[model samples]
Target: MTNRTMTRRDFGSKVITVSAAAAAASLAAPAVLGAAKARVVVIGGGAGGGTVARYVAKGSDDIAVTLINDSPTYSTCFFSNLYLGGFRSFESISHSYDTLAADYGIEVVIDRAAGLDGNGRTVTLANGDTLNYDKAVVAPGIDFKFDAIEGYGPDAVETMPHAWQAGAQAKNLKRQLLDMEDGGTFVICPPPNPFRCPPGPYERISMVAHYFKSYKPHSKIVVLDAKNKFSKQKLFEDGWARHFPDMIEWLPLDITGGVKAVDVASNTIITDDEKFQASVANVVPPQKAGQIAQDAGLADESGWCPIVPETLASLQVPNVHLVGDAIIPGDMPKSGFSANSQAKVCAQAILAELASKQAFKPRFRNTCWSLITTDDSIKVGANYEATEEKIAKIEGFVSQADESDEVRAQTAAEARAWYDAITADIFG
Candidate 1:
């Protein structure tokens, strides 16, 4: 089937169908006051939770869906680097939940989920309301380990912003970059392995370089990497060399001997071999699943939720599903695309188990695109299938360093188009 942009009319049609089916189901059931409807509570409102809630509510009238998120509006982390680079505006990435509630009949709650009782199948909201659920989906994104690097914590984010979660943090980082002196040096300390968005730090460096090349021409960027190699390294290096020559420097752990600590007040990063100072210090610390997951006993010793790959059901908690950055996805990188894909498969599985429908074969796909410059982009993508052991990668594609200019431009356009389509799919 060909993918087309969903219009307001399409959404209206879906709403009508859903309402009619729900009415019919209610009338046909013998139980009183929604006893027949299966309750599903989604514990996040970003890509994974929003998509799952929308799909479950739209696909089945017999299921009652409630989506709980802490914020009134969602700002996507996926395109935040572009906003930092001045390629996009903050308003463009922000989305509202009005449509999800009004159109899809999802009960949208703008409150933090304070606790989860898996045994009792209840979720406790911050306001002291305990809601019961037949099944729950937790898609809460990454939480930073503030103390992973000594002397670095949430209080120091103002001086050295991670901005990994987007919104105000991203804006702050952009403001810092804009205020830096012309010849100043900017430093970024990427997080260790098994964090959200594997290629994000490199993409950020590219975007920062793009900004420095245009506004602060004399400014430079230095990457203090925790890992020796990174995703799409050659493509990023080539783009940096070609577009922002001599403006970006990457230091691997082997060279810098890994970061020991950070001095936010002095704007310095301490490594074994050297102490580097910078005008801006963007330190992305190590990460774990959102705190609510850990509190709910959904996470294991690895600090990530373990799930059955085919169904996305929590290994520790029955009738609960884990998606997005919170789950251990094996070969799949923690990305919005991966989360959205996993949500669909999970929604289908939930519907099959509750609504007595046949389960569909599960297949997941993810593509991460990085903008090197304005209209210069590259991408890495893969298709996966669930095995007895894990979700295994089957086929993959990547943009090459030697690709032609036309191809790179087309790739950038594709990236922008994807952002539009995906946000619409998730938010609408």
Candidate 2:
């Protein structure tokens, strides 16, 4: 099958994407309830939750949307690598919910969701406030499984920053790199499969390499992987060889024995066959659904919430829907683009169910872009359709290894434009 690539350009950079007929029918709230407003409570405020809450609020006037989150501003994980590489700043990637509140009339509650009563349709907050809702969206994102790695947990976070959550930890990792000596070694330990941003760890390696090559020319990078291979493996290997040369050395589990333990106090990674010392260590452990999701009984034994493919309705919780990394998205790779796409499909489903709007066929799309060097980038993407069981990919595209300089530069430009466009699409 031919690779078909769809982007924000295809939909004019719109956030809520539904068929035209269905969109027309959903412009206004249906006059089912004379004066009563349906309540929608959204937990989480990253790409998925922010987009869904905004889309649903814009879908109808007779709907009251309340967005509950622990943080006032959300720092995105999508472009944090660029910050590490010195291409972007932390402030540039962070976003706030002011627009969703001031313009879209979404009640942005900056408080943690302490408890969820799915059967009662009530959400309890950390401040002891309870909210009743007709529908709820659970996009709380991922929480690290600290116990996955021996001798590593919350206590070790400050020393060996995971930086996966992309906020203060990201800053901490960047600071550690800046503080290290010229010839010091920086170690990165990536988690196993089914983690957020499948290609993220590799991208971090690339960005860090870019940083070291410029400032600390003698600095070295070592990767300790739990898996044998990674997403865009060939592309990453090619980039590392061409750009960094001898500066990077990757050790797969079979070669390194395995990631047995770590000593954060000394920044030492103790594998079965060897012990590696580092000036700084980034250990991204295994992850599960965020704590609130688990407390809400949204996750199954697999530690992920399973949702109906068509509606994104939580299989475990009635009247509650989930999107983003916390959910078991079959073909999706837990990316911001995937979460943003899923949120649109979910918003349309919510309108159809609660506001009596025509239902549209759900189409999901995702693209992950990684920067290799200045004005050079590669991307892999696929479009998905919802089935009875899973979101199955229809077609996909990837940047060719032998692409011309102009093409790679164009790909990088596309990524930057996408970040700007998507942030606008979600926040506005």
Looking at model 2, residue 424 earns an lDDT score of: 88
lDDT values for all models: 0.87, 0.88
- RMSDs, each prediction? 7.0, 8.5
Spell out the clash pairs found in candidate 2. none
Pick by TM-score: which candidate is best?
2
The residue-by-residue lDDT of candidate 1 on 42-114, one tens digit each, is 9999999999999889888888788998888999999999999999999998998888988998888888989
Model 1: lDDT equals: 0.87
